[model samples]
Target: MSTQIITAKWIVTGTSRDGDIQMLDDAAIAFDDGVILAVGPRAQVITAYPDAKVTPHPLHLIMPGLINAHHHVGLTPLQLGAPDSPLELWFAARLAIRKVDPYLDTLYSAFEMISSGVTTVQHIQGWAMGDLEAVVGSASSVMDAYADIGMRASYSYGVREQNRFVYEDDAAFCDRLPPETAKKMAAHLHRLTMPFNDFLTLFDRLTDTKTSPRARVQLAPANLHWMSDDGLLALQEKSVAAGVPMHMHLLETAYQKEYAARRTGTTAVRHLEKLGLLGPHMTLGHGVWMTEEDIEICAGTGTCICHNCSSNLRLRSGTLPLMPLLDRGMTVGMGIDEAGINDDRDMLQELRMVLNLHRVPGMDPAEVPSAGDVLRMATEHGARTTPFGPRIGRLDPGCRMDAVVLDYDSATYPYQDTDIAPMVALIHRAKSKDVHSVLIEGDVVYHDGRFTRVDRDAVLARIAEALAKPRDADELNRHALREAVFPTVRAFYDGYLQTTADRDPFYKGSSRH
Candidate 1:
């Protein structure tokens, strides 16, 4: 590979020194053979490598490419004209959408992510259509799309053995449905269900055959409510044997808290501890309802949590106790989680939102999220949760050459101070349109409003053609079944909560949990 130097007006190295973001003003970065060679003063770099080709961005800010710690393929629910609902009901509505080709669906979101400065995404798959062969094929399509687009991705299929929908015996809920609706629901479940062991086997097979430097396959148990004890234990064992990272959604709602209390006689975090599932390798998604004790356990176990701030607010899952989580020294990362405040995969804007959302009415300067903290969470902390190895997110020497360049000349100047830190100003004001270029593995995948590897317009057109028929027979059937079963599912939870309201601490919301 040819050696190259990129001189930028500012380079936010995405590393901290003495609790501050390390910045190099008027610096140049050199890369060769998909690895960073140097990052320092432009004059020194020029003197050091006189023969290297130079690409100068006199009015730009270069930084490590953002990592979206949690994401899913396909269109956003808001785009489908579906309003936000609680996660339990939202799952049913989300399943009512038409299925498109996995490759196109993955590309559709990748385009959004790359354009918005996201270089790596943890793409969690929940689709289990047809047999094992078909499922594996769909997963391969996702991997192929990311590979072709030159985006780094970590992939996992969401798996559960029981309680596919509500937090109870799905069969018992089916018994309340009319025979026809019950049969339709059962068929739908069968279409989307695979044995838990088969999921583990599929993970092994995918990793063995579809290996790539940019793509990783890992284990994910959907959530605490969805998986049985045996299935969770089996997943833990498999994850340990494979030595890959695990991701799961935990306590994203009050309903989940109630369910955990009733089923395990404790909180979800404690239950996972009892199952021996909380550890450095496991990353819990959302974590919106963790109590003080739960936080203590997570902190003790060295578990990481990916905070999806906009997703929680949009779905009314309540705000994650981010300040508390940070205070407890638990590792935290940022994820768009299928949608952000703008209902798109815009990581820069997502960083801004995270900074603004966690401010707790205090006069102390340290009470709110600093720009460096939020940016690190999006870059470094997010990368730590993926299977991308150690040197993935930072922009230092020997790290993978993944970066984003924003045009500081356009909407990013005048007030950007050299004496004072520029991260705070950039985080609050930067927009996705300001992204001028994106590179992964020393390759310029997106530059000057175009993707180097794929035809963006062509893939988008194909996606539109693929999803032209909005509602298929299967989706229509699932909708009818959801309509019949969701009421009972809602009522069961309401009654359970009502009966246990006085006894259960989870029912009381303002308890600093």
Candidate 2:
């Protein structure tokens, strides 16, 4: 590709040495062949690359693209007929979800993500109802969607060696059901089963055959309850040997904490530590139920965490100790897991939620998240959790030219304050509609309310057409099974926590009830 210069009224480059966001006024970024060439004042950049074609966005603010550090599905569970419930029970309710074409389903979310300034996503795919080959096909479709849309994705097929539904073995849990119900559940488990070795094979195959330069394969150990000791060790070993990071779900709910304690006689983080999996290569998702000691262990080991703020609230999982995690100097990333609070993948909205949610009643300014901190979490810190690393997160020399240009006028319309920083104003006021352009690898994938590569309206129409067809026999059977198992799944978690203290809220509310 030929050289091009994109000049904006303001440019917020990556963070500085002191952990503050680096902003430049009337700045320009010159890039060629998907790599950033220079980023500085417009005059300086123009002088450096004098012959480059320029595209000026005088009314826009350009910044590093946001990263969704944790993501699962495209059409969310809510869209797939699964209502919000507690995390444990939500798994059972999710069984009723009708299967959609993976490619179309993935594109459905990719459109939402790119429009909302999310250029890279950590897609933790799981729950494919077939053997190893079918799972691989599903994964390929997911990755293909990202590649076709010109977006970056770090994909991992979540490894679930045990505990597919609740925090119990499949056979053991099935045995607890009625005779007929047990038979169907057993057959369902059998269809989803794959040899442990096949997981490694899947990882190796994906790593070797990645179709897009913008896509990379990583490892996910699903969750603590979902993994056996041997499975966790094997994944850890594979992670180290492959030199790719592993993202695992840990301590998302109170019951998960109890399950970990019951299983290992220790916290989940401690168990991972014992297995030599606590390191920079591992990222724990949610971490809402992590103790102070757990936070310290993660901090000491440089393990990352992805705070799925919206998912926690929607699933009633509990609010994360974000302030404590920040105070400990932990590298935390932001994610719109499943969907944001608005039932869509809007990173800007999620950023504001994270920024305001942790503000305690006290008037301590240092305790709450700053605009810079939230920006870092969405950009630099989020990039650290993915296999894409530093390449796609920031607009700097040698980094890929992935960025979002927001219409400053639109974001700060009808009123204004010159005293407030641009990043602060955008975080608090900007919506996905204010996103004017999104560039990935120097290609303008989305610009002026249109995608360059794909016809979004046509794609959505195709999806609607596909879902309009009658549910197949398998789909109908799964729906019936989900209804039958829902009550039993709910009953299994009755008094699951050992003590009243465990059931009490982790967050101390400001109200004097």
Candidate 3:
């Protein structure tokens, strides 16, 4: 637990009222015992921690580790061939061709995320009914990736009853299902829900893993909208009983809101509130179509909203009122959503997009979020959406030594003002290559384009092998019905695909969704 010095030309703390966005020069961060011990002038810190190790990262920016509030990490490889279909159709088709190996995808995704200085990701993992042993048989490689690469992560598997014929088919779209298929799916879920060994084993095994001082685990209830009323309520209760956070997709789009309202005689968010599922322990993804009242209710209940900005833009799911949400006292953070559709898991890109997306429609863009706001979303706010909220995010004293050093020489070039330096440089230009090094819990997981403790090529190869395999009959059935229903999904969404593929600027380029 010896101390260390991380001196940088620019120190962007992203904390409230932390002077200008950037330090004048030679800013130093000192940490020991897996926690930051001081933050001030380089000369002062050097004098104090003289016996501690000194790793000067000058000509770069040192800041808190980036957090991804929502991302489906294990799908990194299979995202290559994802059809640009509507929401439900796209998900169904994608599921059919999912890579059988969750470990590889998780590894590759973690490596990519780490290279970009994403020290933590709240990753969503989907598994089929019968793939218990395969889906997440051992979270070792993934947890290993985090430990060795010095990143933190959250993982979840679920009891998602995706009735294939539920969307579109030959008059078989009702709740009724044939005996065999239904029975098999049910039995698979039974086993999947009960296997706590892999998660438990990984957590226990990786207690001494490389660089993971802030790592943690939690139960994720995939989607409340997709689950049955009984199932959804049961998951909420279970999460509450286990003292874990309940994460799910809620009011993601107009269609979802419409469907839920039709079924429960109320809006989706309202329905959850009435069911007692909305609370401090709940974190909902998307929240794109939430009404003002719904927003107020969430704030009052202390619920966290994960705004998946990139995914919503790509899926044509409409825009979220981020300003209003923040103004109303809601604890909001950003998520990368599912991998692939505008799908670069780079949280820096997510922050850049968030800043530009809010510009005035036809006025000067000077009023948009200053770079400080964007940085906060990725660092401070992102951490608030998970279990490590208190201990990570900021670089203040007593926080974990999880940090990233950005090379101002490459992706960042020619700094103008020393005052607004970090904001102007980072928000405008932050490439994955700009990351010089990443540290998790005072251990260097990545440095100068390579991981310190893992075989990068082997991980990529394993993910490729898993995705190269084919889907069996049951998985194929799920894919076919969902893809076939693409033509009937609220027509406008069909037009959305045509417009995107055609790159048509006119809103009416296609006549559907």
What lDDT score is found at residue 263 in candidate 1?
Answer: 90
lDDT of 2 by residue, 175-255 (tens): 788899889988988888889999999999988988899999999999999889999999988988999999999999899
- Of candidate 1, the 10-residue stretch with the lowest lDDT total is 499-508
Each model's lDDT comes to: 0.84, 0.91, 0.67
111 Cα displacement, candidate 3 (Å): 1.7
Task: Tell me, by TM-score, which candidate is best.
Answer: 2
- Arrange candidates, best TM-score first: 2, 1, 3
| Residue-level lDDT tens digits of model 1 in 1-513 | 888999998898885622368889999999998899999999999888899999999988899999999998668876764668877778766656666788988898999999999999999988659888899999999999999999999999998778887777778777867798788777777787887778988899899987568889999999988898998999999998989989999988878888898898888999999889999899999998888788899999999999998899888887887777766666788899978888899898899888887776658866666778888889888888898845778899999999999886565555655554666667777787888999999899999889999999999998788677667777677666667777766776665663225432322334455
Q: Count of backbone clashes for each model?
A: 0, 0, 6
Query: Candidate 3, residues 294-362: lDDT per residue as tens digits?
Result: 888899998988888878877777677776666565667777776524456777777788877766454
Query: Each candidate: RMSD to true structure?
Result: 2.8, 1.3, 5.9
Give the candidates in order of lDDT, highest first.
Answer: 2, 1, 3
Between candidates 1 and 3, the TM-score winner:
1
Worst 10 residues of 3 by lDDT: 498-507
Please list the residue runs of candidate 2 whose C-alpha ends up more than 4 Å from where it truly belongs after superposition: 17-19, 499-506
Give candidate 3's whole-model lDDT: 0.67
